[model samples]
Target: MSILETTASILKLMVERQGAIRISDVIHHLGMPKSTASRVMSQLESYGYLEKDEIHGTFLPGPLIMSASHLVNRQLTLNDHVDAALRSLCERTGYTGYISMLDNQEILVLRVIHGRQSLPVVTWPGSRSPAWGTSTGRALLARFTDTQLHDFFASPQVVSQLTGSQQDVSMLVATVARTRDAGYATAVNESVADTASVSCAVGDPATHDAVAFCLSFPQQLATPEELQRIATLLKEAALTIAGKTGDTQVSSPL
Candidate 1:
């Protein structure tokens, strides 16, 4: 692999481990030379993207690298603020509210607020939903490479089960394309009857991996205009959250 790819891979591995990572570990995990891994670590440390603990002698992602992902781990854990936002959304929309992120090919619910209009939101905190059948899933797809998206669409593994709706691959691609243009994704009565959702991808342009954040409501109470409005609101909220958490350069549809 190229030097840049190797460095990026090392950084990803360090983040995944969530703690001080040793150069040896990166070398072993990536099958790269120890000297090359050490050099990468040195460069990352010089850029303030990784730091060495004197006591541990291991490297951990520094504040800068954390900011690149919008400090997603930190921001998502801000319980008080997220709760207030969820409560506000529920009050304004008269429907349940939720925040979620993409994990592989699944949507992982991070928070939820129960309102009068509640469905079988089997998705709970730390739980996941398939990425192909939901609005949040489509939004996440907006961040994939064109090649990756095309391959995913062509792959037989792309699951689609919205009853009486376009479950074909072409339809899925078109939907994602529209989502990319609109800066959000929407699903109506697809995951659940009379349910609606709008989602946008939160990501670091440098990493090219999407961390989607979304809001959902009941379809009965949501109009097309309202969905658009909600999408705008969701995008604004995501930007605010991203700014506060340090992810400032999220790719924009505009």
Candidate 2:
């Protein structure tokens, strides 16, 4: 292959794996001369397309590549819609609002909107929590099929590392069922001690990916009335999101 083709292939590998790539691995995979591969890697690093670990002698995607990836992902996903909804929810409730979705067995926060409160609950994009312990997690999990749920709980090692009190598989199954029936989910001092959250799933079950919108507050501060209001507002916001996405199955709460 030409030098340009070789460089492109190497960069593709780095982007796809999202981890460090060793020079030897690149050489073995690409069948390029050591000298040519080193030259290409050095040039790419100089331009900030790749970063090298001095200690491990491995190369990883650099700031420029990651930024490009982020831009592409933001454009491809429902990031803008979810971000706008979270902001509006935060404004309406004066509590921290966030969008989270299941990532494997964990809940990954995609966006967060800090409330106007002086001591708002702090959360950041890309943060992860236990799937079985957070309101958002449960809300999205409620959409999983029985077989999918069984497969998720089949791995004890995965379940053991989850953040809250250890729960039985039967208990988790029951929780999912309840969440499905309730049209929303609640977690009080579960994922994080002293924190309370309520969430509802967004988008159509068949068309779009499982996602949830959540609002969180101090456990001691969340009153029954406040919780109910938040749940109602979350459902409304979720419906709006589903509508915007052209999901016709808007009859379901989740």
Candidate 3:
């Protein structure tokens, strides 16, 4: 098939599917070569037509696709004040910072700022990661109620991603509970190996457009005190970002 056909097919799949879309799905569904599928999908992502989950390499609708899919007449604003906040977080902590929103059981990255270190922990604007495993995800997941949390854990993606019989939901519950009490979340080697991150969920959890702020670095480089300090900074940035977005859901730690 021609490039047009491939693009249309991928778009159709994204529009119809409710979950994350990986390149393997495109290869499996379209019988296209891996190179071709990756190229087309990458182009779509670069053009804001498709977004890859940075952590899991899953694909989802990009801002353009989402706007059209949702009947948004205006050009979807991807970043504004949030970019500055992400940059500031990076400068303050010398860790890569992220601005993201809850997308079902994942976090959709809107922006990322690499730290002063030469090795940038880079991820695309539209990439996604499972909520159960990442600092940003856990921070947001902490907002879920008992019923919501239980139902969230039941998702195939969540259950499958969790190791061991820990699908018991109790483990996830405890993690979220800690995030709730602390007003931030931390993860080590959860998504990307050797990476440690601190995150805070900002915005109203009840709102479908909830957002989170995160900072990540190499696990070995972080001490307990440093991570805690970063978390406090992240919470402050979260509050600032949430205030800018008019989302007043973030609360102080217990």
How do the residues 8-73 of candidate 2 rate in per-residue lDDT, one tens digit apiece?
Answer: 899767644545898887888878789988988998889888899999999987889778866754
Query: Clashes in candidate 3: how many?
Result: 2
Q: Clashing pairs in model 1?
A: none
Candidate 3 lDDT over 31-76, as tens digits, reads 8899988888899899998888899999887888777745521322
| lDDT at position 184, candidate 3 | 92
Q: Say what the RMSD of model 2 is.
A: 15.3
Cα lDDT of model 2 overall?
0.77
lDDT of 1 by residue, 127-231 (tens): 776677788788878767789888766554444433445577677778888887787888888876677787766654344434665566667757889888888
Q: If both were scored by TM-score, which would come out higher, candidate 1 or candidate 2?
A: 2
Instruction: Identify the superior model by lDDT, candidate 2 or candidate 3.
Output: 2
Task: Report, for every candidate in turn, its global Cα lDDT versus the true structure.
Answer: 0.69, 0.77, 0.74
Q: After superposition, how far is residue 191 of candidate 1 from its true place, in Å?
A: 1.4
Supply every candidate's count of residue pairs whose N, Cα or C atoms clash at under 3 angstroms: 0, 0, 2
Off by over 4 Å in 2: 1-77, 118-121, 162-165, 204-208, 248-250
